[model samples]
Structures are given as C-alpha cells and as structure tokens.
Target chain A: MSYGFVAPYTALVIAFGVLPALYAVFLAFTDNEGGFAGIANFTKVVSDFRFLPAVAHVALYLVIWLVALVVLVSFLAVVVHAVRVRWLSRTLRFVFYLPGALAGASSVLLWLFVLDPTASPVSGLLHLLGFSSFVQVIVPANLPPVFAIIAFWTGAGGWIVIMYGALNNISPDVIEAARIDGATAVQIARRIQLPMLRKWISYMGIMSLAAGTQLFVEPQLLSQASNAIVPNDYSLNQLAYQYAFQQNDFNGAAAISLLLLVIALALSAVFVTRGGLFEKD
Target chain B: MTTVDVGRPARRRNPARRRNSVSGWSMRTIIAVVVAIFVLFFVIPIVWLLLATTKSAHALIVDNPFQPGSFGDLAANWDQLFGFQDGAVTSWVGNSALYALGALVITLVASIPAGYAMALTEFRFRRLLLVLTLIVMLIPNTALVLPIFLELNVVGLIGSPLSVILPMAFFPFGVYLTYIYFNTSVPRDLLAAARLDGCTEFQVFTRVALPLAAPIVALVAFFSFVQNWNNFFLPFVMLPSSEGYPIQVGLTSLLASTPAFNPSSAGAQSVQLPTLALATVISVLPVLIVFLFAQRFLVAGMTAGGTKE
Candidate 1:
C-alpha cells in the first residue's frame, strides 16, 4: 500500500530525469558516422569551432551578470528594507519584475529594440559612444554582454524582491542592537544586515550559475537579427538544437545535451551542499 | 582600549570608515541610476514593440520607425492577422489551450505524488532522488528540447499535442515543492495517529495532507500552464502542422516576416504591427490574470515545505 502510494511519482521521475539522463550519456558516445562510435563524437564536440566560443560566450556573460545581479539586487533589497515604503516598494518591485512576465521569446523581440541602433531610445546613447550601426552596437564579440543586458533586464528585478524577502527575515532585535551601538546605517547594513542574508546570496548565486551556462533565447534572437553572423548555435544548447533539427543528428544533439546535463548536475551538487538548500535558513 | 587589536581592528576600522562615508543619497542615486539604466534597456524594446503594431509594413520600414503611425489601418491589420493564411493564427491559440491544459493536469497529478512521496516516505534511493531533482530543475528549458523531440519522433507522437503535454507534465519543481510540503508541514505524529486508528496510508494522505496542499497544487498548475502557454521551442520543433502551434510560436512566426520585431509580417495577405501587439497582449492576459490572482500563493509556496511549515 505504501509502495502504491509512492509508485507513480517514482515512475515519473525515472521516466523524465533518470532515464533521459542515461540515454543522454549514451548519446554522447554514439554517432551517425559509425553507429556507437565511442569517444569520436565526444572528441568532435570538444574540438568543434563553436565549442570553446560557446563556453566563452556564457562565461563572459556570467561574470558581468553575476556582478550586476549581486550589486543591483542587493542595493534594491537594502533600500526597500530601509525606507519602509511598503506599498510603493512592493509595486515598484512588481513593475521591475514585469519584464520577466513576458515570456522569453516575447522578451527577446522586445529587447531587439533596445539593442537596435537607429531611432531607438538607446540610439542617442550608442551614438554618443560612437557606435552607429546596430551591428556595431552589437558586434559578434559584444553579443555576450548585449544578451546579458537583455537577460538581466528580463530576470533580475524579481531577484531583488526575493532578496528583500530574505532581508525581512533578519531579526529586528539584532538590527536594533547594531543601531543602538551607534553604528551608521551603512555599518549596520554591512555588518548586521548583509551578513544575515548570505544564505539567500548563495542560493541566488548557484541558481544563476546553473541558468547562466545554458544561455539561449537572446542568442537565438540575435541570430535572427544579425543575418546569421551570430550563429544561432552560439550557445551549447542552441548547437544541440541546430544539430537535431537542421542537421538531423539526434545522437550528436543528445551528446551535446548530455554535456550540458553534466554541467547542470555538477552545479546543483555544489549548490545543494554549499548553499545549504534544505538546512536551517 | 587605547591599545586596540593590531591587525583585525585596523581592518574593521578602515571598512567602517569607508562604509560610513558612502552616504545613503549617493548610494540611492547611483543605484537608482543603475536601475533606471536597466529599466531603459528593458523598457525600450517593449515600447518599440508597442509602436510597431501601429503601422503598415511599408510605413514601418520607410518612415520614422519609432514613431507610432496612424490607427487608420488597425482594422485591416486585425483582419489580416485573424484571416491570414486562412485563420492559422487563431488555430494556434486553440492548440495552445489544449496542450497547456493537458500539461497542467499531468504536472499536478505527477508532481503532487512525487513531492508527497519524497517528503513523507523514507524510501530507498530517496537522497539520490532529491539530488537528481535539483539537477533536472537546472537543465535549461531548451536543452532537453531536441532529445525529447527526437524521442517523441521515434515513438511517433512528434506532431501530436502529446509530445509537448507528456513532457510538460513531468514537472521537477512541482515534485520538489510537494516534497517540501510533506517534509515541513504534514505532521508525522498525525499520520501515525491516523494509522493507529486503522486509517489506511492512502486515506491519511488524502484526508489530511491533500487539503492543506491546495496552494502548492495551484502553484504547480499555474507554472505548468504558463510554461506550456508561453512555450516556443517544443512546439516549434515537435509539431509539424501550424494547427498544433501555441500562441507564442504563432506570434513569433507572424513576426518573422516583419523586420526584427515588426508586427506587420508579410504573407499572401499583409498584416500590421498593432494586431501583433494586440495578439501579444491577448496571449499574455490569461497568464497575467492567473498570476495576479495566484501570486499570493507564490511566496508561501516558495518558502513552504522547504523550511518551517
């Protein structure tokens, strides 16, 4: 009876995560060329011209992204914490979060305008900086930061709200003592407040790290705008998609997808352990 | 006290002085500027999208692109969007409803049980299951698209709604949510008592835990629905027919003909931009309405079952 109670979910997890994972690993080995060709496909994936570039794409994006997120979101959380402007802050957070409310495909379409050169609101700023062509505004080398701008635009505001919620959890008494000790608001915040929010920071970092590596939509949209100069397959997953759909090599697609899975798994492991996801928070 | 600790005290003092010098105004102003910069970065594109729908395709390309053109052709645009390629876009909306709703049901049924099982029972391989679920949660949405598409193709469900729906139902986040609910909220002692009173295990779950789990169930349903509703990649690949495209995919296919994000996509019949924005607006309304009503539950759901019940 207990077994029956648990069976369906167990089956579902195995069906979705576990079995798919095993098959993905299997896919990393076999190839259309020789059928179960062993390390040949894995080697090709490693040596593919786009392989390191794709990793570089996400890495540069992640650095800018992680720094921007930590600084901006923390600032948003702290200010909202200080002002006690309850309704206004909540409404502002929601407005900021609205971009995320637009699904990725929609948001990408919207972002093209921000990145567009002529007659766009951003045109003046880009002109001031001497980037006249929209293509110049986002050369192949600059695509990472451009997408980071777009991804952060759509996603980061909600994170501010999440961090603020964690900030609320800090005990008022500890805050009061820091205040009574003649600590400046900055001192109180750095010493007493931000320290307490470390768990949320760690959680946010890991989640961002995991999500950052698999960057897609912005690149996909970029490819659409850039006349194939930006290979839609600039990200690993995009590479997988092109391989499967355009190239029709399910096995190669699976191999790349599996590599992505391993990266995600390893990151999750680090997070679940270091982030203390289920521990006392 | 005058003979303060040598190294540590000096380090603390330096940081404190710097921090104190950083007044709230500068911080607020700078942060606000940073946020405004991001806001403009995000807002411009959406505003451009809004303006795009107001023009004819010719005007959209030839005229001042950013300026909103006359609404003289709004009706004509709408007619083309709805009637273009023989009402193909409207069919996409119907298909989306069918797939999202189907996925929502499966997500609820599958996730609740999975969450419950992980939370309540001390089963073997449970720790591994927990770890694996976290991993699945992190896999980018589009990463598995190809593999799943291929699998469905081999099994011959590629063009059917089942390709999307079956995959969507297997919601890892929902499972984690349910597990958290069980772990934190459901009192173990109550379950033991129910068992002692001759209540079957199934009875204990349904009678006690299920009622309180409503918020999470609703959360899972909302998430699954919105994901399927907004999804582009899965339907783009798996469904061969336009009849199976979701609203997002349909909107995108419509937008492809227009430059970048222009609403006036070129077809046998010309369409305009505002209709596309209107279509975008229409596609988003259902999710927004659901979200506005359901957001109160989100905070509770995210925090719930994961920590103190």
Candidate 2:
C-alpha cells in the first residue's frame, strides 16, 4: 500500500530529477559523438574567455545578495515581531511579503523602469546619486548592486516572513522568564531570540546562497535592455545557455552546469551536516 | 544583577523594570522608523508601476512618476495594451493559467501521497527516497533546468506544453514539506485506531488522515501554484514560439518591444512604457489575488521549513 502511494512521485523524480542529473554527468564527460572525452570539456569551459568574468560576477552578486538578505531580513523580522499591537505586526508582515508576489521575470522587467531615473518614483534620490538615465544607472560597475537590489526587492520579503514565523515558533515562556530576570527587550532579542534562530539563519543563508548562484533572468534581460552593455555572459547560467543553444557546445554547457551542481551540492552538504538540517525529534 | 538582587528589599526592582520599559519605548520608536523606511522601499516601486499605467509614455518621463494620470490616458493605455498583436496578452494569460493549474494538480496528487507514505509508513527505501527528495529540493531548480531541457529534447518533447508542465510538476520541495507536516503533526495513534476499526491502509489515508491535512494541502497547493505561475526559466526555455509563451515570458517580449528600452527593435506595434507597465500589472494580478486569499496557508508554508509544532 505504501509503495502504491509512493510510486507516482518516485517515477517522476527518477524521470525528471535522477535521470537528468545522471545525464548531465554523462554529457559533461563525453565528446560530441558520444566518445569519452574525459575532463577536456571541463577544461575548455573553464578556460573560455567569459568563464572567469562570469564566475567573478556571480561570486560578487552572491556575496552582496546573501549578506543583505541575512542582515536586513533578520532585522525586519525581529523588529516586526517586537511590535506590541497585533494588527500592526500583521500589517507589517503583509506589507513586507507583498513584493514577493512579483518574483523572477516579472520583477526584473518592472525594475528596468524603477532603475530609470526619468520615470522612477524615487527620481529625487536618483538625482541626488547623480544618475540621470537608465543607462547611467545600469553601468557595468553597478550591475552587481543593481541585481542585488532587484533580488532583495522580490526576495527579502519572503525571508522576513519565514524569519518572523520562526520567531513566533519560539516558546513565549522562555521569553517571559528572560523578562523577569531584568533583561531588556533588546538584550532578550540578542541573547535569546537570535540564538534560537541560529539554525534558521543558517538555513536562510544556505538556501539564499544556492539561489543567488543561479542569477540568470535578471542579467539575461538586462543584457537585452542595455544592448550588450551588460555582457551576454554576465552570469554562469547565461554562459551555460550560450554554450548550449548559442554555440551548440553541449559538452561545454554540460561541464559548466556540472561544476555549478557540484558547488551547490558541496555547500549544501556542508550546511546539512553541520546545521543538522535533517535532525529527528 | 547583584544590585538588583540586593535592592529587592528596597523595592528598587520596580524602578529598574520601569527604566527598561522606558528604553523599550525608545527601541520601538527606532524600529518603527526603520520599518517605515523599508515599507517605502517596497511600496514605492509598486506604486510607481501602478501609476505608470495611467500615463502616456512621454508623460511617464516628464511628469511626477508618483502622480496619477487622467482616466482617459489609462483607458488609452489599456486599449493599446490589449490591442497588442491582436490580443496576445489574453493568450499569454491563458497559457500561464493552463501551465500553472495543470502542474498544480499533478503536484498535489503526487506530493501529498508520497509525503504521507514516507512520513507515516515503513516502506522499503523510504529513507532513501526522503533523502533523495531533500537533496533534490536543496539543489536549486534553475541548475536542473538546462539538463531537463536536454533530456526533453532527446525525447522530442521540447516546445510542447508537457515540456514545461511535466518538469514543473516534479516539485520536490512540496513533497518535503508534506513529509515534514505529516511527520510532525499527524498522529500515528489515530491511524492505528482507524485500522482497528476495520479500515484498510488506503481507507485510513483517504478518510481519516487526508481531511486532517487540509491546511497542508492548501499550503502545498498555494506554493505549487505560485511556483508554477511565477516560473520563467522553464517556460522560456521550453516554448520556442511566442504563441506558447506564458505571461512571465511574454512580459520579456513586451520589454524588448518597448520603444524606450529597445528603440532599434521597436516597430509600428512597439509597446509604450505605460502599456508595458499595464502588462506587468496584469501579469502580477493573479498571483497577488492568490496571495491575498492564501495568506493563512502562506504563513503555515513559511513556518514549515525550520520549525516543529
């Protein structure tokens, strides 16, 4: 009976998840004619002119994105939770979570206009920063921060919601006890709540880091808007796509993707083992 | 700490608590200020988007971006937007609904049962299956999209709706969430009692357990729906034709046609900034509605990851 219940999902997972992953490994190590090419594909992809820049771009974006997501999301979640009024707290959460509805491609397209100083609602701020046009705002040096802002706009709210829920899950009795011991709200928040949220913070960090590495839609679209001002291979995923479809270098694409998969899996493995992500009660 | 203990006899603890409360009031003020700034950061862009739809392309640049334009301009923009490619926007919306809802059904059917069996039953390879689900869930979906595309290409399913829907329906996170929910919340004794009452395993699940899993069902459904609807990479890769484009992918096409952004590519039917903004608003409306209605389930889904009941 259990097998009957589990069969459908298992079939799909094998077909979609397991098979594709294995297929990627095969493609990465093979030449175009199905002959084993060893690590030639990996070396070629790593040595591509765009490879180092793509890696650097993704690394820079991930660092900024992950740090902002961790710091700001946690701060907002903690602050919103501390609000005494029930309705006020609920409102704050709702407002914070509102932007999450605009994930991925839609948000990216919308942000093109937001980054345009002429049409931006916050043009005053843009003017203060001395950016007068969309092109000026989205210069190469600004792409990482630009992508980070777009990501944070659509991503941070969900984390705040998750963090707030984790905050709520903490036992109020423990907090009450702390308050009775002469701990200020700030002290209690730091010493008590934040410590309890360590696992969750790490969980957020790991998940966000994984997502941050897959920065495709933002840069891909920006490349179109900027007329190749943002390089076509501005991210690793874009580079992989270029290799696969644009260049018809499936082996190279597969090798790059495998490298990414290894990075993601290795980092997640570290977090899973160290963070006790699968701890049983 | 010593001072507080020593002053307990002098009734000084009350003053200390009072002092803490005073500081707490100041802390609240600072938090409010910070939260308000964040609120502006989030709200202003959306507000600009909504207001942009009411203006002409020229006015959107020249006028105050926050100001609402005339109703006539909004009507004109709406007409121009809906009029694009003889109402391609409508077809994109339909495509998005079809893909999202189709995947949503499969996700619910597959994930719920798989999660239930894993969490509640001692089946062979259950631990292995759970571990596989976690690993897949942890691996970002985009990382798998290209590989999945390759596999689908070999099978000649590329550009088919199944190419998008089938891959999307394989939502490992939903299964993990369901597994977590059933493991933590559902009572095994209740199932055991149902079995004693002459219920088969299937009956125990269908009648006794499934009803109790409504919140989780809604949570999984909402997430699956949102993920499927907001999905861009999968559909963008799968559908080679604009005719099959979902709204999210369609929005990119619209962005390219907007004269302000891509003047070299713009033609007679090029999109205006206001029309483009309206298209964006239209694309987001369904997700926004679902989010508002499923707010309760959303909170449940958000909390499910790292916390126990």
Candidate 3:
C-alpha cells in the first residue's frame, strides 16, 4: 500500500534523475558512433587546453564560495541573533532574503549592471579600485572572486536564513544558563553556538562543494555579456555545455559530466561518512 | 573568568546581565554598521534596477546612475519594452506562469505523497530511497540539464512544454523538504490510530495526513514555484522557439539586444537601457510578488531541514 504512495515520485526520479545519470555515465564510455572507446574520451577531455584552466577556475571559485558562505553566513547569523532588536533583525533578514527571490538568471543579470563600471551605482568605488570599464572589472584573473561576490550576493542569504534558524534552535535554557553564568554574547556565540552549528556548517560545506563545481551561469553570463573577454569555458559545467551543444561532442560532454558526477558522489560519500548528514537517532 | 567570579560576591550580577542586555555602545554601533553594509549589499543592485527603469537611455549613460528619474520616463520605458517585437515580453511572462504553475501542481502531487510514504511508512528500499533523494538533491541541477536534454531528444519531446514541465516537476529538494516536514511535524500515533480504526492506507493518507500537511504543502508549493519560475538552464536548452521561452530565458535574449550588456548587437540602438531595465523588472515582478505574499512559507521551506525537532 505504501509502495503505491512512493511509486509516482520514484518513477519520476528514475525517469528524470537516475536513468539520465546512468545514461550519462554510459555515454561517457562510448565513442560518438556508440562503440566503447574506454578512457579515450576522458583522456582527450583532460588534455584539452581549457580543461585544466576550467578546473582551476572552479577550484578557486569553490574555495572562495565555500569560505565566504560559511564565514559570512555564520558571522551574520550570530550578529543578527545578538542584535535582538525585533524589527531590525526581521527587516535585515527580509532584505537579505530578497535576493534569494531573485536567484538564478535575474540576479546574474542584475549584477551585470552592478559590475559594469560605467552604469554601476558603485562606479565610484570601482574607479577607486582602478577599474574604469566593464572589461577591466571582469578580467580573467578577477572572475572567480567577482563571481564569488555575485554568488554571495544572491546565494548567501538563503544559507544565512538556514544558519540563523540553526542558531535559534539552540535551547534557550542553555543560553539562559550561560547568561546567568555571566558569559558575554561573544563568548556564548564562540563557545556555545559555533560548536552547536558544526553539523550545519559541514552540511553547507559539502553542498557548496557540490554546487560550486558546477559553476556555469555567472561565468556564462559574464562571458556572454563581455563578448568572451572572460573565457567562454571558464568553468567545468560551461565546458561540458559547450562540448555538447556547441561542438556536438556528446561523448566528451558525457565524460566531463561523469567526472562531475564522480566528484559529487565522492563528496557525498565523504559527507555521509564524516559529516553525519544522515545519522540515525 | 576568575575576576567575574571573585567580583560576584562584592557586586550584584544584575548589572552585568543588564550590561549584556544593552551590549556596549561600541558593539551596538558595530552591529548597526555591519547590518547596514549587508543591507546595502543586497539592496543596492535592486534599487539600481528600479532607478534605471525610470531613466531614459541618454540619462542612463550621462546622469547619476543612482539618482531616480521621473515617472514619465518609466512609462516611456514601458512603451519601448512592450513595443519590442510586438509585446514579446508579455508572452514570455504568460509562458512562465503557465509552465511554472503547471510544474508546481505536478511537484505537489508527486512530492507530497512520496514524502508521506518516506516519512510515515515502513517500506522496502525506504532508506535507499531517502539516500538517493539526498544525493540527487545535492547534485547541481545544471549537471542534469544535458543528460535530460538528451533523454527528451530521444523521446522526441524536445521543444515541447513537457520537456521543461515534466523535468521540473521532479524536484528532489521539494520532496526532501516535504519529507523533513512530515517526519518532524506529523505524529505517528495519529497515523497508527487511523490505521487501527480500519482506515485503509490510502484513506489515512488522503484524509488524515493530507489535512495536517497544509503548511508543508504551501512550503513545497512556494519552493516549487520559485524554482520553476527562476529555472533558466533547462528551459533555455529545451525550448526551441522564442514563443515557448520563459521570462528567465527570454531575459537573456533581451540582454543580448541591450547596448549596455552587448554594444555591437543589431538591436542595441532600438533596445534602450531603460527598456531593458524595465524588462528585467517585469521578469522579476512575478517572483517578487510571490515572495511578498508567501515569504513566511518560503522561509519555513528553506529552513525546514536545518532545524531538528
């Protein structure tokens, strides 16, 4: 009876999620003609000039994104929690969360304007930093962190809301006891709240690791807007996309996607083994 | 630490607690400043979009970018935006609503029952299903886009609404959110009582569980809508015609035409900056309106898995 209830989404998941994933893996091993080419596709993709640079670009982006998300989100959550002014906290949360509503393409488009030195409201600050044009602001070397800032602008709030909820989950009795014992707010945050947030921080880390490796939209939009001043295949997913759609190299695209899937699986494995995401009561 | 303990006997702790309550002036100032910076970080770009929509193309290039332009220019911008390609922007908005709402209904129907089964039932492969859901939830949606594209192509469904709507309906995160909500909030005793009273499993789920699942249903609906509405990659890849394009995908074509983002485009002269900004505003208006109305549910859905009951 319960199986009946589970069947619909299970069918959907298999058709949409699992079967495609397996098909992607299967396609990765084949040549364009449907014959098995073994590791040739993988080796060819790795040797492509864009491959290592794309990997490096995403590696750097993942680092910045994960670090900024964790540090900034946790810090803001604590600070917002400490402020304790009812309206201010709610308003701040609402403002922070506003960008989340603008996630995906719209936020990326908005940041195009924000980063365009000529049209940006922050043009004064951009000029102070020695960037006088859109191209200068999004140089190849600056793209990762620039994308990180944009990612943070739209992405951080959702995580902040998550971490803030985690912060509020701390039992009031524990906090009351700490307060009665004369622990300062910082001490409470540092010694108590931060430790309590370990599970959530790990979850964020693993999830961000997975998501950051698939970085596509920001660099894609930047490259598109800047007319490829930023490299078109600046990240792994964009490379995979270009391989599939642009070059009609489905095998190569599948290979690159399989590599990403392996990384995702590896990260999930590590998270399950070490991060306690699915710990049973 | 020793100082506080030793001084406790000589002085009352109430002053210290009171001090804690009011924090120091310096800390308050710092908190206020940091919050303001964060607020600006989020607000400035959106505010810039709003202000830019009110300006003419000439004013956008020459005048203070931050300064608000007159409302008359907003109407002019609206005219240009709507006038482009005989009101393609309205068609895009309509397509977005149709696709998003259609996918949202499917998401609710599929996710809620699946979550109910996972949370309330002891079944074969339940643990496996949960783990699979978690892993799929974590896999970036973009990673699946190409493979799903290939799948849809094989089925000859590419460029059809089902290509976008069907794929979007399989929202793993929504399923997971519903799972967490049902697992935490719904009591087993109630289900057991229904079962003991000879209610069939389907009847129990339909009558008892469904009524109690409103908040989560709303939560899942809000998330599914936002996700489907904001989704760019899938629809961008799937839909073949401009008419089938959702607003998010449509915005890119609009961006390509705008001179500010693409200077050498053929439509650059005709697609003014304010008109493009107004298009951006219109594309986001549905989401902004949904958010304004359903923010509580969005928040609850977003943070549902974070807190352990």
DockQ of each: 0.34, 0.68, 0.62
User: Residues A57-111, candidate 3, lDDT per residue (tens digit)?
Assistant: 9999888888888888899988878766799888888888788778777888888
The numbered model that scores best in lDDT is: 2
* Stretch of 10 with least lDDT, candidate 1 chain A: A272-281
lDDT on C-alpha atoms for all candidate structures: 0.71, 0.87, 0.84
Q: Candidate 3's error at A118, in angstroms?
A: 1.8
Off by over 4 Å in 2: A279-281, B1-30, B307-309
Q: For candidate 1, lDDT tens digit of each residue in A1-281?
A: 54565566667667656766776776667776646778777777778887898888888989988888887778767876776667867666666666666776676666565566654555667778888776787678888777777778777766776776777788888888776465777787788778877777766777787778777767776676566678887888788887777877777788888777777788776766655556311
Q: Write the per-residue lDDT of candidate 3 for residues B1-309, one digit (tens) a residue.
A: 997687677455456655656666668688778878888888998888999999988898789888889999999998888877788888999999999999999888899999989998899899888888877876777778888887787789999999999999999888898788788889999999998999999999999999999988888888888889999888988997999999998887787787776778865246876787788788888888888777567657655555353
- Candidate 2 at residue A52, lDDT? 96
Off by over 4 Å in 1: A33-36, A117-123, A131-133, A279-281, B1-76, B122-127, B196-198, B260-271, B305-309
TM-score of every candidate:
0.86, 0.94, 0.92
- Superposed model 3: Cα runs more than 4 Å off: A180-182, A272-274, A278-281, B1-28, B195-198, B266-269, B306-309
- The clash count of every prediction, one per candidate, is 4, 0, 0
Of 1 and 3, the candidate ranking higher by DockQ? 3
Residue A232 C-alpha lDDT in model 3:
81
Q: Give the least accurate 10-residue stretch of model 3 chain A, judged by summed lDDT.
A: A272-281
* Candidate 1's TM-score: 0.86
TM-score of 2: 0.94
Best of the candidates, DockQ: 2
